[model samples]
Target: MQSAIETARKQLPKIRIELVDCYTGSAAQALIALTAARAVKLGDNLNQIIPKVNKVIPEAEITLVLDTLKYLERGGRAPKIGAWATSLLKIKPVVTNRMGHAHFLGMARSRTQGIERMIRTMRGKIGLNRVSAIIIHSELETEAKELEHRLRSEFNCNETYVTEISAVVAVHLGPGAIGIAFLPS
Candidate 1:
């Protein structure tokens, strides 16, 4: 990113370019981007927006429930043996972002159980604080909507969004993957 920024600066000396690594991906990254955009919309200059974006980098978090570990094994993100074991037991893997990497949380025997674990994780993180959240899924709109409803009902959410996971991310998570990204406001 720095290289790209330098290259662009040479071509357009008057233009300003800033890059921020949110230390996370998927919906968490989206939330960080939204923070900067909101700051800009409120008439904040680049300097002001950078600080706001940085402040959110640590606060934002994402948790995912994958239907299977096949895709992760295929992508070389998981060991073949682990994937096979998970498949054999029919367990959904629960994952969360920590220090910019996907960290395994636990496993659920069913999708509904996985979603409940996700909600519990979020509740533990934010407690009664108001939050902003995004519920993301891959080819699972109905489940995503249900997750959204559950989140709103259980938490003090100031804003909530439901969205389809990007195709690039879905390629690795595969179908039936559901995730939630939240920021305590």
Candidate 2:
């Protein structure tokens, strides 16, 4: 992406090229890009759009509720001891992107609770009725739709998007992994 942006910059010296790392969250990345697109549509120049995009990128949040820890552990993202403990206790881990990395927030005894906890955390950060959200899942359309419904009902957002997780993301998250990324409006 950086190379592509650099090429565009060379072709259009009048336009500014800015890169916002979404910390590996596709949904969050989408939100950042969306912010830039909106700014462009509003006729904001590179200088104006840069600050807007930068502010939104950090404000963007992604909460992932993993169905299992095996994939994360296999990918060397989870500590062996933590994975073993969660597995033994039948706990589902809820993770969030923080400072360009995934951070463990807490665990839930059930998937339902885990999702609710994630929603609550997002609500605290973004507040209700003032967010735009995207839901992504790996081979979990039903789960993804349910989450989208919750976001619409809870956040009252008109710009909610539902999408399948990309193959690259799927390799690490595995099936049954669901996440939501949102930006406060």
- Which predicted model would earn the best lDDT? 1
Query: For candidate 2, lDDT tens digit of each residue in 1-185?
Result: 88899899999998766776656468888888888899989999888988898777778888988877877888998888877887788888999996487788899888889899888988889764578889988888998898888788777685899999999888888887888888887
Error of 2 at 65 (Å): 0.6
TM-score per candidate, in order?
A: 0.95, 0.87
Error of 1 at 85 (Å): 1.0
Model 2 clash pairs are none
Poorly placed runs, candidate 2 (over 4 Å): 1-16, 22-24
* lDDT (Cα atoms) of all candidates against the true structure: 0.91, 0.84
Measured by TM-score, the strongest candidate is 1
**Residue ranges of candidate 1 with Cα displaced over 4 Å:** none
